[model samples]
Target: STYRLLSLVLVEGARVQPHYIADTSRRSTLLELRTMHHIRQAVAALSPEGAARIAPTRIVSVHDIAPAPEITARRNRLTRRAYLGGQYDWLARFAAQFDIPALELCIHVDDKAHAFISEHVEQVEGEYWQLRKELVDTDLSLFRYFRFPVLHLTKLEMDRLARQHGFHEIMQKTWFCHSPWRGRPCGICNPCVYTAEEGMAHRLRPLARLSYTLLPVLSVVREARRFVRRVVKR
Candidate 1:
């Protein structure tokens, strides 16, 4: 959804200094890379002649860098504080270097569609709109280049926008899995779950769809395990 929005932003005369941040913690796979390429191609196909001015995407790896302890401590409830902090820090520096005034993020407060989900909360809580806004406004305040084009729209709204703009096919090709098992989406992962719940289960493969069907039972088992742990502690 975000990718399609970004592509539209570029098509509508938003100059893009393309960069892809590869976070090791997320375990992005070859499938994602291929889909990304296709998205780029789709964008290029829409560009007017000689207007394919979008730069080649520069892949920036955050595998070796530890998230700053201060940043992590501030957002202890959120699992990817360090990763998010680190990405913003690097982006700020990069923007400064190139004199880029705006960095557009496809964050939708309505759907809490920022990349990171919290370990301490249920999926809905993890995507709590206000909580995500606070994280962006507080911890990620290092740069003034932040611009959110779709901040007020929900995921479903974004889909509607894509479909209205005739990019629904490309939207279907976009990748969302944070973890891939054997080159397929790990159906129980947060991204997969969100995708399914958001009415994009058709995006998942047959095997993933099967796994998604078991999600409710899996949730029950997880809660039972947590309950047993709490009882043991008591």
Candidate 2:
């Protein structure tokens, strides 16, 4: 029922903004609706016990929740406006739909801090550190309305969190093996690097294998671009 409702809303949203929906690599709103319908049908075919065991007791939607208003009103806020807007809608709908409480899982990785190699590095000097610090200090109100737990998880902790969210490491490994570079998972991007590192640490060998194979390909493409630029100058 939740899936059906969400599909209807997504379809409506897409109808309202077809061009905006069409521009992204994510499934077209129509396709998403179809996919959800297919999933629901498959689940419905399962035995009651099987369905109950597999189905989430509480519907969970993980998002990057925004900081509190006090934090957002201040200077150097890292949370974007869209983050806040999405949180509002997600929370409102979640409250309305579920008879039992829904869990608004907010996952925050300290991206700016993660970007810095070391404190002494010029790339992450005073301003960068200060900005990251401000972001870290900001109050995130994820716990206010739902069962929110702040996890300052390292790469390893993130894997544990994923498992807690019903994704087994083996399943995750299989997913990475099959569709390793889908969408923005550019094999050379920071996210790819981090994912690779985490998977290896957790002994998700398949994910590590995919990352190793693709990262070199991405690096070669990047180098080829640099070479092309240099040649074009002549």
The number of the candidate with the highest lDDT is 1
What's the C-alpha lDDT at position 123 in model 1?
Answer: 24
Candidate 1 local Cα displacement, residue 30, angstroms: 2.3
Can you write out model 2's per-residue Cα lDDT over 168-188, one digit (the tens) per residue?
A: 332232222222243223343
Off by over 4 Å in 1: 1-11, 25-27, 46-51, 64-67, 77-101, 113-145, 222-234
The alpha-carbon deviation from the true structure for residue 87 of candidate 1, after best TM-score superposition, in angstroms, is 7.9
Range of the 10 consecutive residues with the lowest summed lDDT in candidate 1: 119-128
Name model 2 segments beyond 4 Å from true.
Answer: 1-23, 27-105, 108-148, 158-191, 200-217
